[model samples]
Target: MIRFENVSVTYDGAAEATVQGVDFEVPEGELVLLVGPSGVGKSTVLGAVSGLVPHFTGGTLRGRVTVAGRDTRTHKPRELADVVGTVGQDPLSHFVTDTVEDELAYGMESLGLAPDVMRRRVEETLDLLGLADLRDRPISTLSGGQQQRVAIGSVLTPHPRVLVLDEPTSALDPAAAEEVLAVLQRLVHDLGTTVLMAEHRLERVVQYADQVALLPSPGAAPVLGTPADIMAVSPVYPPVVDLGRLAGWAPLPLTVRDARRRAGDLRERLGGQDGTPEVSVVTTAPPQPEAPPTSRLRLRRKARSAPTTAPPAEVHALAVRRERVQALRHVDLTVAPGETIALMGRNGAGKSTLLSALVGLVEPAAGSVRVGGAVPHRTAPPELVRRVGLVPQEPRDLLYADTVAAECAAADRDAGAAPGTCRALVTELLPGVTDDIHPRDLSEGQRLALALAVVLAARPPLLLLDEPTRGLDYAAKARLVAVLRGLAAQGHAIVLATHDVELAAELVHRVVLLADGEVIADGPTADVVVASPSFAPQVTKILAPQKWLTVAQVREALA
Candidate 1:
């Protein structure tokens, strides 16, 4: 069992305790969920358990923490290495080896395990995590989801008594997230591994969690309860769950099938004329009127540009040749004037690679990419700035200026943009303490937001983002959705590669799934996400697969 007794931990050079008064316990083999907004001490709780809090982070800890009946303070991370396994939010941070297979064996080898034992454990872990095929693949070639799975597998190879993960699915597509979650579920249920994880995408995980430990931001006591009880009070919830709550559904179905069964009567009562299941569409208080429908501006908030009805003109995007990485397999894809396309797949699935190839950052070995009728590399530097923009998965690449104000200014200046326009954009988008503080000093979540804001300031016709909301808080995430929706409505061709299935269902029209550098599936977001091969649909979809995308869309479609 693991226990945090009124724990409050403060890091050196930091102003406050990342986690404060966290009190919780995980009984043996119980799957526990530690959830909260980013930077709210969720990771800190994991640190306490793994002995990274005071041992490595140099924090002032005020409470006791015990794991497996042993106080964590007395045991360093190395001492607890064999007993407690932890995978952090950033998979790259934990990786030390050069290849996938070697990384798996690194831990076991260090523990002086026999070669046979190490080989058998590595093979078992690879198969268990669906990574057997990629055993020979380089770590750098895997998708973000695959890398995260590898991180989990690397830890699990030791068979630790307790396993802790920090937002393991935040970087994966819906299908990949489901794959990882399914493995974790099996571990806890079949293998009896004590599992504790903190994740922002609650819809996919809440149902499987045996215990819910919610820390509602700092300065609050952690709220502990069963999944049902926690869902009743959580401020954040998936769209269907929220709808169920408002509609007064009993026991509040966690999956779509359950909701469908419970909602039949409600649907009938709403009155049906056509064959549609009949849900209501409240036309009242419509969101801000549709923005202009032109690719030069917003993408989603606007209707498809009238001229875009003509078949989209295809343009070549990227070309690359590398020693061992076949990043793109002579791929050809087109983006209509205002389409929102989500790139989904496991990590190293070439989602990030495809985005890079499009942006001219990573050259494809076999084919080339283009944007707005011109090759990305062939386009003039400043011209390329306006035609396409990219936000790399690593937010640091987007950051450069000392202060947030300066960062926005630099981005605006990049495309030979106007100061008034840039200032206007910065003021409206950032519009907070970001104006004065050093951009680099902010947390990863804050940096990501600022970077996105910077990208927006450039006003590119095509916007590409890789896991934009990886570290965002709930409110911030909602704001991001609003921004992207506004962009799409305004006429920008927005292409996002994300693991956030629920978000894609809310915002996108189509999805393209890549595996092993090949396009496995490409079609309407609704059609594909509903029955994605890698993952069953989100609970909302399971509740109502026909309405697989968003609650508003589902409700409207049913009506």
Candidate 2:
């Protein structure tokens, strides 16, 4: 359905091509996953299919590109709208209307579909994506995941033959991500629609792909094959693949079920292992005396031996209302010095709200939020820097300067740090990025690194990061883990609101699960994740009942 022949894309002033010799084909009714390291041109390749690379993005495209037999070289994006639907990473950029229902119908109206057909498709999409209840809601008021669904449904209403999606599930929760993937699966099976998606969260989509295309690096040829064949050698892969490799399983499994089927012996080998290690810090709240004996024993054993007079930060009965919605309700949390905590939940569960409250972006209606003994909302901006710092979900929101060097300089000035502190942090977090490049021109991961560097410059006592791994590849994510770990070890309390379960399993000491607007569960990482099937990492699912939550844990046990 889509074909790229000897395709190469060179931007306006770049010395080398962003993508070169990229040849791939997606058959009718199939889902092709485009994956590579950050800045390896996966997005460039996906854009070429819809005639956006050279036409809309101001780049030079060489060689033939066709979608549904229409040559992209001759057709612009608008001309191919009926045959192609492209949803970029930023959902807010895709919306042209204020309300959900209007956004859903806008594409159909533009396509000039019959009134009855348009109405039918609108209703069908609303029901398919569980957006019926939100039809009258303003697009800006919806959560990030809700906006993502609306963006997808807007395009699907037009009934395009090909769908090109970039990081479709990055903002979605586990259930919502599954729902979106299921919708894609149905489109491929029931409607014979072809999909080309570039996503960084491979663990959510790798098992659903019909074909895997690996772009090793920029200007290099793509390697295409079945999922297993590509995953065996691909640098970027899901945790299940890592577990399979660690266990020496032949023909690495793509899904948890397949790995679970072959994990009986490995489970036996790790039979007596106690994978849940003790936490390094104590909670500010007193333990419940009425708890069960086993639970109490476990908590006592896992609790730190050293006592702390006060945590670095604390949230007490927090309640936040945004517009008409209560984004958070009676939420209580504590961040101890030298601790790493992961805040996890479904979409619209108030994780972002909590982070905002901690960072003083949102004021609590009822309860208090204190960072380093001062209420965050009442603290002054200049003083807040030394108390707490946050790396927001949309990394670009924290960036305003034109160039990377300027942004770093601004960060240094704002934080009162050494002249080159931010730049040095950027070098440590994300190496090899040219200083002169515009922050807007950098890939999503690079932009995120810049934002993180800006936040870390202050060296705050408490750190809050929301979805920090959104666009990061495995290597970048590893570097991030190490950085965050080092910060925690240096008396900086870290809290990350993320949907990346693998990250939570591998990096965090504790997991805090939120639902609706309340804290539902909070415990050790292994205990919290292993209990929830939807939130468990792939390795944990495969090694169920063994209490092993990550490949590193399994590797340690095996050794």
Candidate 3:
């Protein structure tokens, strides 16, 4: 029920179209997944469906885009609201109401639906998205993932014929993502609703798509085919597909079940005495630099030799209360020099709250938190800068300068570092980003890199990141992994709050699972994740009984 004919979009001042000659068709009742690297116009393509591209975004639209036989050019977003529902990447920007229940009912109210029907639809959406318990909570008090679900439910309550979503599951935990995706599946199969979604996390959604549309690169026409056909040649793919390709499996598997079905012989080949790989593969470390050791490197060497060195960060009986919500409860944790830890759990879990506690953003209601031998809550901002740093979930919150160059310069002054140190970190994390670009103009992943660069410029002993890979594609994520791994080896203790299990599997030395503001599981990465189906990475699930956590590990073992 959606068609794009000879489409191309160019912003007001740009030289070339962001997307050129893009043409595709989505049949009614089907879910079409738009796949591509960041900045390849996946968001732009999704915008065209809801008429946000040229209409509200101040861009020139070429050719035609029709949804449910209504031309988007003729019908503005408001006019098409009856048949189309769109959720952009930033859910906070999508809300007009204060509470969860109000937000879910706002769209129907705008559509002039009967009050009874609106109430019924709102309740259905709340139950469908697992937001029933949060119906009375204010939107401002909810977590990032909770806000995302509320945004989705707001759109879904209108009962539109078409759903256009951008990174719908980016903020959700594994189980919550599955619930949202399953709801979309039910819409497509039972209700004949159409869904067009663009996402960077292919592993979570690729197996559920009815068809796939690939935008290979910037300015390239989309390639449309079945999921398997697109994944085989597509530059970006999930870890399961990566494993299938590595194993030379014909007709690459899209799901863990399919991969496991074909993995019997391969499993035997890599199996060792204790149901683990014979050679333990180290996938997180980057190659050592050849340059002379810097002061930070020397400090790392000293810490390694000095076993009595204090941990970078320590927490005991930490409890944090936000209004009536007990965000964290009697949690205890520790971070050593040169160690990387992943804080993981379902949405509304205490992961972000714990990071906030360590960074001194939130004062602990009970117990104590110390970073670099000083109580975090009582430490001065200037003094804290030397001991710890934080890159928050919304990367934009850390950025304020007009240009990338200015931001780097400001970071250098703030951290008392060398002039080019921050820029150098940006270059390593995100290459080819020019200095003149505005922080607002960059893509989500690019902004995240800039924020990370600013935090790393200080050369703090303890580093904390929240959802660092939200907008990154596989290639960009690899660059991030390399940078983070290098930092961990240089005496920087890193703690990241994330829901990306693949990232946790590949980068973290330990996994700490939290639920309801309490730690539920804490142990080595493999020991913790391999035992939990919801938290295991694709490779670990595919090669069950083997403690492999990544495709690189499997490839290394086979070699």
Top model number, TM-score? 3
Clashing pairs in 2: none
Question: Ranking under TM-score, best-scoring first?
Answer: 3, 2, 1
Tens-digit lDDT string for candidate 1 (1-559): 8988988987766666767878778998889988766556677788889998889878688889988888888888998888899998778888999888999999888789999999999998887778898888888767677788889889988888899888787777665667778888888888788988887777778888898888776657789998777777876665557768756876776665667677665545444323333322222222222222222121212123222122122424333444476665656688765667888776666778777766666544556566665565565444445466787777777676687777666665553456655455544444444366676445456677777776676556678989987877665777787787777676667888887776676677788887766778887766677666453344334344233345564455545
lDDT tens digits, residues 1-559, model 2? Answer: 9999999999987888999998889999999999999889888898898888789889789999999899999999999999999998878889989999999999999988899998999999998988998899999888888899999999999999999999999888899899989999999999999999999888889988989999998789999999999999999988889888888989999888899899888877886344342333434433211111110100111111222235667999999999989899999987777778999998889998898888788888999998777677786564555566778777888888888999988777666568998899899878878788888888878898999988787666678888898888888999999988887766778899998898898898899999989999999887899899889988878877767777877777678
Residue 461, model 2, lDDT: 67
How large is the C-alpha RMSD of every model relative to the true structure? 5.9, 7.3, 4.5
lDDT of each: 0.69, 0.84, 0.86
lDDT for 387 (candidate 2) = 61
Alpha-carbon deviation at 426 in model 2, angstroms = 2.0
Q: How many residue pairs clash in model 1?
A: 39
